[model samples]
Target: MFRLILEEEGYEVHLSKIAFEEVHEVEKLDPDLIILDIKIGRHNEGLLLLQQLRMYRPTMKIPVLICTAAISVIREQEEILQHKGIPVLYKPFDVDELLHIVQQNLLPSETKDC
Candidate 1:
């Protein structure tokens, strides 16, 4: 659903499967942004992956947009508050709002991509 809406907005997008494997695969994709689902396995959740990924020097700098059906998503975002550049996106969102946030984060400032 999110992917379809986002694609219609003229932005290229990639949606990953909900699993520990997908997080590791992110490095290969080298996407500009990521939309993460906080929960993964019934036994092992993605919070641990988030921590592991954050510790990885290469991916630590990546901006993450989190969306969850549960309000507890707040706590997860709070845990990563100290992380320099992670952005949180709540569920039940407006498509425009999501795009705006994405553009705001990915858009260039005075600093060029160079």
Candidate 2:
């Protein structure tokens, strides 16, 4: 759903169903931004992957946008995510809101003007 929406908007989107194994490939992909969910197959895999990415050099700077339905989990990690300069988008959001957040998180040079 997100892939189709983003692709229609002229952005290349990559879907990773299993983020843990693919986390290593993220540096190679070198995407301008990453939209992450809190639960990826497991309860805390996303958070763990986020930490791992942050610890690495090349992938650390990539912008991350958290999109999840786990409101309680997000609230628990809100301070940590804020300190890391990451933004969160609650689930059931409008498509326009997603696009807006995506645009905001992308590098200025990479953003496409609508």
Which prediction has the highest lDDT against the true structure?
2
* lDDT of prediction 2: 0.84
TM-score of each: 0.75, 0.90
Cα distance off (Å), candidate 1, residue 59: 1.3
lDDT of each: 0.63, 0.84
Each candidate structure's count of clashing pairs: 0, 0
* TM-score, candidate number 2: 0.90
Candidate 2 stretches greater than 4 Å from native:
111-114
Flag clash pairs in model 2: none
lDDT of 2 by residue, 42-75 (tens): 6668988888888989988888999999999999
- Candidate 1: lDDT of 61? 68
Residue lDDT tens for model 1, 1-114: 866776776556766566546445767666666666676667336566677777877777676666665456557566655365666666888877887767766755311110
